[model samples]
Target: MSTVACPDCEARVSLDTPVLNEIVECAECRSELEVLSTDPVVLGRAPEVEEDWGE
Candidate 1:
C-alpha cells in the first residue's frame, strides 16, 4: 500500500496501486482528491464537476 498526505486535510491516505487521474476521497476532510502522479504518489484537490447546458 502507498501512503500520501491529503492536500486539504493533511491526513494520510492509503492507496492500492493508484493510477494517474484517479479520483479518491479524503477520510479526514471528505474532500475529493485527484491523483496527479503515481511515481511519488502526489495528490491534489479534484475539480468540481459542472453540468453543461448543451452549449
Candidate 2:
C-alpha cells in the first residue's frame, strides 16, 4: 500500500485501494479530498499458451 500526504492537512492517504473516483474527508483538517487514481495499478504479462496436442 502507498500513502500520499495531503497538501492541505498532511494526512497519509492510501493509494493502493480499489475504490477510485471518490471523495474523502481529511481526518485532521476535515478537508475534502478527491480520490483520483489507485496506486499499484498495473497489467501483468500475458501467460504462454500451451499446445493441446497430446505428447
Candidate 3:
C-alpha cells in the first residue's frame, strides 16, 4: 500500500496496488480522483461524468 495526497482535501490516502489511470475516491473529501502516476503516487481530479442519451 502507498500513501497519496488528495487534491481536493489534501488528506493522506492509502492505495492498495494502484495502477496507472485508475480512478479512486478521496476518503476525506469524497472526491473522485484519477491516478496519474504510481511511482511517486500522484492523484488528480477525475473528469466530469457526461450524460449519454443512447448515443
lDDT of each: 0.95, 0.55, 0.92
Q: Which regions of candidate 1 fall more than 4 Å away from where they truly are?
A: none
Query: Candidate 3's residue-wise lDDT over 1-55, tens digit each?
Result: 9998899989998999989999999888899999998888899999999999889
**Tens-digit lDDT track for model 1 on 6-29?**
998799999999999999999999
Question: What total of clashing residue pairs does each candidate reach?
Answer: 0, 1, 0
Clashing pairs in 2: 15-39
What local lDDT score does residue 45 receive in model 3, on the 0 to 100 scale? 97
Instruction: Tell me which of candidates 1 and 3 scores higher on TM-score.
Output: 1
Per-prediction TM-score: 0.95, 0.49, 0.87
Q: How much is the lDDT of residue 49 in candidate 1?
A: 97
